[model samples]
Target: MYRVSLFPTRDLHLSDLRVALINYICAKQTGKHLIVRVEDGDKAHNIDGKDQELLDIIALFGISYSHLYYQSDNFKYHLQFASTLLDRKKAFICFCPDEKATPYDGRCEHLSPDEVLNNPNPFVIRMKTEPISDSFVIMARNKYPTYTFACAFDDMLQGVSTIIQDEAYLENSSKEELIRHAIGYDQAISYTHLPTVHESEKSVQWLLDQGYMPEAIANYLLLLSTPTPTEIFTLEEALSWFDIATISKDSVHFDMEKLGFINREHIKKLSDMELSKRIGYACENIGKLAKLYTKEVSTTLEIKQKIDVIFAKKEPLATFEAESKLLQELIFNAPYFEMFDEFQAYLLEKSNLHDEAFFKPLHFWLSGSVQGLELALMYPLIKNYLKEIVR
Candidate 1:
């Protein structure tokens, strides 16, 4: 069985996605159970519903798990393991002030039992670690099990054969192993530590809101500074070609430009009706308009921004302010025409505004830009809603 831990201290980051994806792939390939350990024991730092939110994001990526466990739910088991260590003289009670002692300082390791019981100050439990693994706090003064203690015992009790975690937890992982060995639960386990994506601190939902598609985000995470048979693929499609051994040991940085390109490619895959509905419209013409704008922009939000300007009230260029006013009245009373050329010719002759004078304000009135898709290409799709587009 493979396990992944999700901490609710913050929204799931790109590194988290990497962890989830790798675990899912490995478990699926081997036909073993995958478990999700929600490390939400730190109530003070946890965000309400963030644990569920992280799971939702993982689900969106199509990762499957056999069981879900909350670290807090196994509170009793964690305490039992902590006490066993204490009874064996492998751990001790420390009366150090909460803010006074740093991790693994061993300041109170020598305290006698009488001195410990006589002390009235709040105390935390610290493990007496071997030289290879540094000592650490097992249980806090609040009676809550520290992450290392809770996670170590849970993994041992639950039969997790493999753990995939970010490199940031490298030291903590070794300490968890130390605790397990100290407690005499010595079943062999495999650990795979992944490098963090240097600049991906935003939550998964943040990326979605910024208009990056889930497929695109998955594609990027799987291939960032790594080799891939192809540049773009769905999460499921990567399963066949994805090899766990190919993961890089060094960290990689996020590249917004490459992701933008991937996002654009995914956008192109959406149906016209789907595209229309995504930007608050249902008409196919609106969909077509959005797709046309895709050549110039990379995200759904960017496409909508360009499409929205056509329906918004006009904002003419200052250089063509006079031409704008003249063209506005000419367009309001102009006869309906099926083509941009026909409508344009009528305005050109009626306003007697030649070349730049005729076209610049006309461009702004219709699309709110002096430079954009040729008016000829845009006019037909929008002609039915010309009045709405120009005003």
Candidate 2:
């Protein structure tokens, strides 16, 4: 069985990342079981939906974790450990609130468990931290007093040997080491701290100034770790590259426009018929793709008008306006032709450019949106119908 743990502190985002890691790791190392534990020991700092939504999101990724553990579920264990340290004069029970706490309040450290027990109003168990010495180094603005006694024991009991975390947590190693000693787990577990991925600092500052979509944020994060950065691949190639180890640590900037461009590129690579089918499917879901130039349901009749005559030898227009001012202008301005007959004869004379020119109007007129099936594919259906009609 593989034991994994996360201190799902205040944000679900971190929890989701934890789940993603576990899912990825499990796939790479098959025949291994997975266990997930949430660290919610700090009830005071707890956030809503910490349990249910976190579970739901993890499951949504389709990873089947064998066992799930919650820290709060083991509150008695933490309390027991805290109690043992207290009895041994290793930890103190403090009743002080936020505003009045002091380092030397030795009030609780010195007080016997019984004494504090009798005088208790509301008591929070605080582990006795080692005195301020050269040992404690400041990394960020916050001063970290390692919980040597608790963290070590927990990590060892959980059997988590390698930690995949961010570098910002490097300073916590001291406390984790202490806790490791407290629990008597001597086995060495390698720690690989990943770089913090974020949009550029400037982009983050800009987001703070304006606003952004959470989906956009997640999309950016996924792109930061997207498997294929340069290579354009088909569906078959994509399904083969779903490994979690492929994720990168470089922070990606958030750009909805860029996301749209990438998605359009992906959609464009599909063949016309496939593009039409996918558009229909996308339309059913969001109705965004259904509303196109053709008032009708993009049937063969409408598609043919332009897609068909693509290879025709002549421009068959029955009416000037029916061909649209744009197409009319192209034909009228032709240097080789003086009249309609001359234009048709001239176009028919060049078989190579004939089909291409016929497809141009429909390709240009329909599918204003970027990247999809070629418009020419639909021309065969409506070409004959538009034949003398546009004359």
Candidate 3:
């Protein structure tokens, strides 16, 4: 059994990434119980609907977690631990207001519990940390021994043997280890921090604001930590791939081009039948999105119907921009390819060139894009659509 704990933040991208790692791990090691502990001590971090949504999304990826532990459920325990440390003189309730407390001040550690309780100003609990030794590691900004004292204790109590997290949190590993030592619960857990998600600056900012499909985001996260793209062959793929030892401590930038490339690969992996379903889904989604597009664009289902034919590879149509000047000139004289002879003659004349070369002129006049579905399919769809246009 391996205990894993995390503070599930609202960044769906990271949450999904962690889920993917966990699922991958379980699949690789059959029959190992993976426990999930949610760190919700900071009431400020609690989101109303997001936590459940995150759990559901993670489940969608197939990581079987044996127990879901909520740190909030143990707040009384945290307070109790605080009291123990206080009794042992290892911690104290600090009367120092947050604004006035600093590493230099150390005001809280020196105060008596009675003085702290009686003073009753805005205060918080503080650990009585030992002076910096060569052993101390800087986990984050200011200079506590790291992982905050409370976080390490919980990791011990929960028996977390390993942690797979984002690279941004690597240094926290050492600090956490140190805190475990201070509390004398000191068995070590392996740490693997994966790279951060990367995307183009503009797209990243936009995704941050508008959000993305939960499935797609989760899929993308799996891509981030998996050994290879092929590792995600099926839903079962998620449970078998977690290995904390392999995660790199580097920030993974969210690259749009890379994402587009991955999207295309994912698109290709769908079976033709699945593609048909996705085409339908895309149509529905596009219909909703049409309201946001420029009015000049057609909002009719008819256009979507025409476009989906291309996606299905049934009567695919190359965009008009793809057509060559010469092909465009040839197509300009006549519209529609009803006669096999005319279509054959056109293909024969363009035979000297590549298939893309043949479609250039025709594509230019029809779809207005340079490249897309096959000519065999596209030629007929556009011809049929144009005939409709004329009628």
Cα error of candidate 3 at position 11, Å? 2.4
Model 1: per-residue lDDT, tens digit, 97-199? 7623445566788888889888999988888866513557889999999887788889998899998888988888888888898888779988988888887
List the candidates' TM-scores in order: 0.89, 0.51, 0.62
Ranking by TM-score: 1, 3, 2
lDDT for position 115 in model 3: 74
Candidate 1 Cα outliers beyond 4 Å, as residue runs: 98-107, 315-322, 329-338
Clashing pairs in 1: none
Give candidates' CA RMSD values in order.
2.8, 11.3, 9.2
Which is better, 1 or 3, measured by TM-score? 1
Q: Give the TM-score of candidate 2.
A: 0.51
| Candidate 1, residue 376: lDDT | 85
